[model samples]
Target chain A: MSAPPLPRTSAEPLVPVLAIVGVGLIGGSFAAAVRQSGLVTRIVGAGRQGGTLARAQALGLIDEIVSLQQAAQTADLILIAAPVGATTEILATLQPSLRPETIVTDAGSTKADVVTAARQVLGDQVGQFIPGHPIAGAEATGPEAADAQLFQGRSVVLTPLAENSNASKALLTRLWEACGARVVCMEPDTHDTVLASVSHVPHLLSSIYMWQVATAQDSDLRMALAGTGFRDFTRISAGSAEVWRDIFLSNRPAVLAELQEVKAALARAEQALIDGDGAALEDFLERAALARRLWGSRSGLA
Target chain B: MSAPPLPRTSAEPLVPVLAIVGVGLIGGSFAAAVRQSGLVTRIVGAGRQGGTLARAQALGLIDEIVSLQQAAQTADLILIAAPVGATTEILATLQPSLRPETIVTDAGSTKADVVTAARQVLGDQVGQFIPGHPIAGAEATGPEAADAQLFQGRSVVLTPLAENSNASKALLTRLWEACGARVVCMEPDTHDTVLASVSHVPHLLSSIYMWQVATAQDSDLRMALAGTGFRDFTRISAGSAEVWRDIFLSNRPAVLAELQEVKAALARAEQALIDGDGAALEDFLERAALARRLWGSRSGLA
Candidate 1:
């Protein structure tokens, strides 16, 4: 069969057909945003469950529901938006049907593990896979929560492998920019480590904190008295458990290293409290407060 | 000098002259809210810094900037909204000029510590001090951030002393209600424990996390990659360092206990990660996610 080559640059209808696996918040939003940008003519969604794909289609996030094999064989690009734990299996399943011209990327929170999975499964075709993470999320999940504006003013990091072609990198960059995301490229290891500090470990700590509060003897009263501070502090704990679980396990080393640092920081604070050193405690708190305030102001967060 | 008795019911203009010491966010907002409720005829602001009091006055949160002694002598009610560490000094200053009928309350985050200070300084007049904790705050502080609707639909815990009269309790409850807060009564120790679990410990943990991230070797890259989740998780860390230092010290016992529990919870998570126990990790995450989601939905927080 003879097929026309897909466009390799920023042009209208950049993707003739785009496939999105696991049409949850990230996947569904990607489909919606790309469709709205007029970069993709058709979006085929695949997932472990049929209901999610159907919902994505109904919500206009996708043009059709298709099998992973069908998506791999037919689409110019396939985005695996499933949990990071499923990356290996998804890559294996798609490898057989993958077209050499198809450029596959993922929206996993961790990059190094995804890249390793792609290399192990795709072998010589690893160049087709670009590990990417969109630095945007919400407490809400699933197809119903997808929004076209979800990627607006958000950061999307791409960890391109050495085997990846320049054309594919340029095309993927252009496509994400079309969705209103600022795209940054970095090494997979660096991406994993940086994300571990900012995202993965924070999520782990928040979940741990929430678990402690929920399991306490007076959890009912504690919950009742919890105000905006607790609400915001624990907001990330309400994220998809399976997704976060995979992220933590996949980036275990970096996460553990970051967690150790956090423990050290807390121990210093504990020491200050135990010694009744008001000046030391104040100094510790003031440093964090000042840093947080500067970041909040610079980031335009109210 | 003899003065007429203050109204002890939910009547209009309940406070003829209200004094708000340390007119920062809490005190300034209280002044604005009470004045809007038509419960306070005039609000006198006092703080360590003249600029803050002047700003509060200019913002119309208070009618005048007066000394603590003057406020104690002239006001129907005095709200010591200064830092918990300053509670003893403020109460001591007010005790000498205190009018018998004047109701003294506070808006401290910790109740037991504030109550202890009030008892120490007010002596026989401890009954006049109704220890209260407003379960509301914002990352922003100062007079400029004052909002009249800040207390609307919020909780205000009152830990009335055994020496207190029913009339004083009734008047304080009525005044808080007029400011659009739901007043709940509890023991001072209970208030401290509950708030330590929900507020104090969480603030400490958030600050610790922020400090760790800010002081990391690749902090610039990590901060650049930080998104909404990090922003929300660390928002409380941006709160006034001096204010939080006082809270942590004042409620040291409860906060330390809660921090111990959090460390235990994190240790369990660390063990699961080390053992590569996906099942245990998933279970831990699922419980917290379910609890947080339920609370978020119930609290009408989107």
Candidate 2:
């Protein structure tokens, strides 16, 4: 049985100044939840768009807007919540201003790239960085879509750097716990492969299927006839294009591998249909239906 | 703006006797809805399993259990809600017993085959048959899973035969409208092609994706980390294997045609990923996202 979410604790904040970079859905939601829990004294948000950063502050997702360097200098903990492709540059800019005792973590969906970025930019201060990917979010984006309960009953995976200590890992774990997330620790590469099969490839395939149907000659008629099942099956394709594009590029190898596997499976299914092999096709669908039926309960998503 | 669901016209019934061929999700729900609308004096259910039929009667989904011939002799309206492949045989047996004026309709997912079966089995009385596909269902099946409101606000597509009179079409349309469905009439081939693109291919793709993920060595870990989006995207894959197999096999040509279209799109997306062409990938995803975002509002599913 699963344990209860959120442990009892005092009202003391986790860090004096918590800085968030790229204040979009992930960063904004993290700020809202941590701020609601009073686990940080101030949330300083930094982003490429000055307007978006200011709006994040106005929405109370952040206490102020600042430059990446300024945030690195003042904050005790820095959260990089940018897309995976931008993390390398963000970490590079923040490296020069970081103090040795300060902790840094990121919320990118693809983690191996973030680890490589840390290795290149943070220099010897890489020990302070803990790479993570929160298994949460919807197709919606921005500060306006932020919710304090976004991470409740969700899992956050942390992939600590070789330079990290046990105390730093504990501190980061506690921080996520305060936000009501069940934290798991795994190697960055393992996280990438697992997520490729479970999330990234699914997103790509859904988008691909949607593109196939949407650009077809009878798309208007097809769309009219589509019901809730079709809607649910392809809803993830509506996610932010830039974010998904980055994920596809950053996690290309694993995504490509899984796509090949699916292509092979679909070929067999198509052949079974052409051959009029009802028994063979039923066998194929049987395995999937049984597996998927058993998945909902064990899959925390339910 | 749409009007309220059911009219408050009369305690009078719509049909004196309504017969359901298979007392499952679609047929049982039809029984419940029409009965609640006070639109049927007697509901007769016929299936292979006497035990299941008894349960349906206990649940009030049917007022009596009868043989197909008996139902044909008495019921003014006979609803063939069995699986698609079985409908041909069912219609053949019911034809000899069916009264000349009796109206016969079906609730199959695939229609071209049903139209052909009606043409072959019901002979000159084929004019009484209306081939239909209700764009509503849940992951659940069986009589116990039936709901009176299943068809409310949903679309019901009817593909009538050339022999069908205006009166026959109007009667089927009115019966569905009274059950709160928005009815649309089109050619049988048009219905099959639209459904092949919208429903059949999505179900097949989802099952293949699930099979791909579940058969992997790291399936346990992948399932653990999967989120609600994954669940919703793959939910249809959990539907009955026999039902889906019949759908794929019965609608092979159109399903294969659509699958080829999807394969081409997937290959294109994969190429963009391999080329690291962010702009191309973004363009591909942008079209899908825009189409899907707009689909929910126009789609009855939303």
Candidate 3:
């Protein structure tokens, strides 16, 4: 545990012994990817679900399953790879046992809340926390869905604290790059705002749309007629409620702002339809279609 | 064309020659599938875009490209494959030259309005018009996107007129079956209502979400970080504006009803978030996840 923290590059053993606080898809995938890259010598997973922890170890996503206390005290690096809402409690539990040189980071969807939780729980040791959000996941969940290439070419955003040492930030960046991700730095507020607009709003809307279809009086008939369009549009509606509930509540303000924006835009289309304004509706649709196609082609998607 | 003139089922040349008015993805795919099945001797395409019509012929989706007038005058079956809003005008122009043995049908997304258009333009000839919705399409369009197997194993809902002779209905059913579709009969109004809840609403919501993202102040950054979730959620927003505008206008009342239903469902989630009710939000999310997962497996999509 030197002051400069080894070499902070690919030459260094970034995670010689790493500890992951949650053994779900995100945590397991992080463990799998870093281990595959030879950046981590061993990965210890700790979670409330002992069965899942054991399974993750069996699947080679982790080297061993340990208790939270043991994970907090021994690892060279700590990853709080749990839900955003769980940040506070986990940080509080680990507060008494944390070693200063052990770089602590997280893979939570919401950043501002995680920052607040770190400040409250870690006290003066908050500098150890460099909050991160990897914009990658599947509809599937758990350690069983973990993939070694999950982070390849994907974007991972890091919100660093002013108290965070330059060596620590650079080490985190190199570690993520070794895992095959493109790392970008941002303010926690900026991360939360952008994510709410692009990710959280779409997820909530998809769920709402699915609930509407499934609860309608003639729901069975309606679903029977649904096609590829409906399936793709509402695919995220199948994501885990346990994970999404925390994301929504933790990022409530930014999410609410984006939701309001969606409602206003939708109202314009609804108004155009009610008034039989074909021209207005067409213009609205044309603008959206053009934007989406431009982005789709730029992003190399069909 | 003629009052119960042609014999129904595959007993006769169900479609010795067929005319498709739009000749885009839907129309071209219909022609391609039927032609592959040997149910039609020749497929004639009519559209404002001569280039696309020519391309359809070159792709073998259509056997010939002709003027709307020529197609209306010569074909034994006139498939009004244009937009729903174009149905009335097309029928009005075709009414003067239709042969008595010709049986007319359409592939419009909305049934009730197409039935209205047929009634208004075809007069007593409306009995020959059977409205159909294929319930299959992709984000891509044009002749290049047309697939012969587009309708295979997919449901095709037919809303037949009271005036439809047993022969005409039987013939239409047999033709779709030939193209490998499972055809189900329904009332036009019922078809519209069911489609509104399952299909139309999802498309509109996706557009709204995309528009929301594209219009946000930091839209470029947000979209840059968008992952598979946003891509899947907004897939349908890339559909043709010109085509969707007509469907939205023609199916106004039903789409609006479903849109309202979505708003109500969304409001409940919004309330749960505002009240900081994790249990309520979790419950709301659980129902949608279960419903979507069930449907996904049933439909062979994950």
Candidate 4:
């Protein structure tokens, strides 16, 4: 179900020097897990000018914080875990210092945009850039929230370009597996479309709904009356604004397309209510209830 | 703060006999809590012809399973926790046997429709019926999911009729307080409108999104890739289908009104994406993120 098993020999680290850019939740957690697995000799973290990189170092999530160029020069593997919007700039910065053998991967939510950015900047060196997305996230952020078990039993999607060699793909796949993730391969466009339907659109719609309710005239009263359901439904809206903003913009095409479908679905529901069609309404709700219940049971998230 | 501090006297049970019309999550929890509080001598349950009433009795949440008429004839208070669609029929059955002093209340999600149904069926006895919406819920249902502390530290909103005496209002307030819930009062229309903004619309929208995705051509792939955000956002869709169906229909006007506003918000977001207006998109998301984070922190739900 996953890539070939990690090619390991006795007592050898999988990565000699690992570099993580944007040491936030995903990056920090990857460092923690890989370190815990004893699969990396050293972890260097680079992030936007802030205490996050220092915090990651302090929390033992990384060996040190360095400049992007320094990280690229010294690293055997560089993982860009920043927001998708910053991908092109980060790639451009890394291109000059990047060694031919140093493989690069990312943890962005959108794949196609990141792939395009990598191709535009890396050019002939793009073969070393393998795109990835960890299908794991939480509302929490920063180094403090990173856990060694963050990616345990989770799926990590790798959308490798045609230029990539099997060895480069296998290395990243092995790294993700070492962090306890199941690696799956997908086409970049399909990955973007699928993720847009399930993740990007849900995030945007949740934020839209939250914004509407929070800015309404009776917002105070409405907030006071909201309960567990409202809390859970809007929980994702509390995520990092810059990160999600980048996601929605990067995956705009698929997201806008799915939003049309969601709008159509809402219109049908509204029509059922306006027509007072109890049978139609009940049938609709029942289908949703059944599907949701089945998924919850199967996913163990009920 | 909570109805004259429960109007208590030392060592005396607040209610002698309590009747729960539907032995589901809300009603069964209420029975369990009141029984544990020693505020009731007996708890009788009546539900749609099924194993639910018997199951509630077996779980010690109810002392007996009886007909609605029997419950009306003997109980000091009757709580109709059935779906709103069943409220009228249940009220009609209880009206003939309802004692003048037997106060009636409900745990429906919508208040205005429940109020109208009570007025239609209970007629002159409408004074006995108090409309309420509990600001607590879980995806689980039935007696098995009932917890005595389900309402603890939760808000229970009551929309009292003009016909209701101070004594009747005070009794329901005291009952909810005994179950560790803070009781608040609102006009029937106001309660419906507020809940429409927070709870009802979210549930309907979540269900519609879930339904659309679950029925899509690549639903299996989408579901496979979905993570925690999707789970939390759509958890409410797994609720009782009949219950939510009735909630949407019963609260049609308010839900429809809220849906219009939600559509407008979504349209704005769609336009922002189309124009690639990063500033506008980020601004919209930032506002929602701020509001959601504030609410989550203040509500201790973060």
What lDDT score belongs to each candidate, Candidate 1 first? 0.89, 0.86, 0.86, 0.90
Q: Write the per-residue lDDT of candidate 1 for residues B221-251, one digit (tens) a residue.
A: 9988899899989999999999999999999
lDDT of candidate 3 over B127-216, digit per residue (tens):
877888898899898989998888988899998888887887877887787788889888889999888888888888888778878887
Off by over 4 Å in 3: A1-12, B1-13
Across residues B188-288, which tens digit of lDDT does each residue of candidate 4 receive?
89999998899999999899999999999999999888888999899999998899989989899999999899989998989999999999999989999
Clash number for every model? 0, 0, 1, 0
Stretches of candidate 1 off by over 4 Å are A1-11, B1-12
Off by over 4 Å in 2: A1-8, B1-9
TM-score for predicted model 2 compared with the true structure: 0.96
What docking class should model 1 receive? medium
- Poorest 10 consecutive residues by lDDT, candidate 1 chain B: B1-10
Evaluate residue B9 in candidate 4 and report its C-alpha lDDT on the 0 to 100 scale. Answer: 66
Q: Go through the candidates in order and give the C-alpha RMSD of each one to the true structure.
A: 3.6, 3.0, 3.1, 1.4
Rank candidates by lDDT, best first: 4, 1, 2, 3
Ranking by TM-score: 4, 1, 2, 3
For candidate 3, lDDT tens digit of each residue in A1-302? 12344554545566788999998899999898888777778899898889989999899888888887888888888998887778888888888888888889999999998998899888899999888999899999999999878888889999999999888888788778777888988999999999998889999999988988889888889888889998998899899998899999989999998888888998888898899999998888888888899889876534
TM-score, per-candidate, Cα-based: 0.96, 0.96, 0.95, 0.98
Using DockQ as the measure, the top candidate is 4
The superposed Cα distance between candidate 4 and the true structure at residue B203, in angstroms, equals 0.6
Q: Tell me how far the alpha carbon of residue A187 in candidate 2 is from the true structure, in angstroms, after superposition.
A: 1.6
Q: Residue B45 CA error for candidate 1 (Å)? A: 1.2
